[model samples]
Target: MIEKAKDLYAQLIHAQELVDNSTRRKVLIDSMRELEASGVNCQSCTGCCCTFISNSMQTDGVQTLELYIYLHDKEMWNDSLISRLNEVIKNNRLDYEISTGQGSSFRRTYTCPFYNSGPKGCSISPESKPFGCLAFNALGKGVSAGENCTSNIEVLKQREDIFENNEQRANVYLKSILSLDWDKLPMPVALLRLHESIGKIL
Candidate 1:
């Protein structure tokens, strides 16, 4: 599974390098619209997708930072939230590493910080949500809901392609701007790093 994730990452990187910025943006916009139209309602579900289950999608540092910035812009940042984020990272840090062909991977399982239990959904705008969150459909392959979901499989597949393509473009944009290898990082760790970065700049 780790190797498969790494290969997908590599492929995205390559695709992003080959594609132009304008074309990437257009694809992202069109795909996002289609994904929204698919309407696989999570309202009735238990928000299982927000929880870091055995095979939940991983987030990268760039997406984490973007989410943090979005919340900060909305005046959501406070000392209590920072402390909670720190505690989350400390409690969930993985002791062992999973080896991917590119390098050793460090990931952990934890409920997303942006997830709210009452509504049991994301606090941020859907547009600001991480690529992993946007790409994932409980109705898609490898999910428990696959059997029960009524969403058309064809539409779901198209959504997956668009999500994957946009995610690659996003990664490429991050790489060009940050000039760093944007390996997928555990959500807690990435959020913690984003908090620290904001502290430095502020």
Candidate 2:
């Protein structure tokens, strides 16, 4: 499973031109840079966005594979990570599926396993982090629900436009690796399922 994910990552890197020249991605990056310059960023406050309080951060197979490879390279793909993911799922009832009508079902939200409650913030690098994570940013100078933070829907839409096709292809490839049929899933659940595919007991 790891090897297959690596192969996919390699293929993505090989075709990096689209990513490099994507105008939508450039706009999103520029917006982030502007926020940083204006001192409107997530710094001192706790990671409310990463928690299940109001977060439902979902990721497709491509985003999951990016994070998986990043963790493996950083020596973070170990028993500790597995345990954290499992605990998050069990504690928050993330395994339970809710019917969204029209024969669609979705999993519950939970704190992301990669969220380090420290200065480092997210364990995953910006490049490997999910688009939803990236687009959720601070809107003001300090913490406040109304003006302090929110998800930039426009930025998220821009990124989705740029990578939608890649996400579709990745989900198709990943279906052969795991028994799951979900195209996009809660971040922790997806990662845990992928790790379990290798039969490595937590």
lDDT of each: 0.53, 0.70
| Candidate 2 weakest lDDT stretch, 10 residues | 15-24
Off by over 4 Å in 1: 1-39, 54-57, 94-102, 118-120, 140-182, 198-202
lDDT of 1 by residue, 40-144 (tens): 345455555566553244566445655555666677767777776677666665323466667656455776777775443678776556544554454532333
Report clash pairs, candidate 1. none
Best by lDDT: 2
Counting clashing residue pairs in each candidate, in order, gives 0, 0
TM-score of 1: 0.58
lDDT of 2 by residue, 55-104 (tens): 77777766776788788889898888888878987898777888999987
Best by TM-score: 2
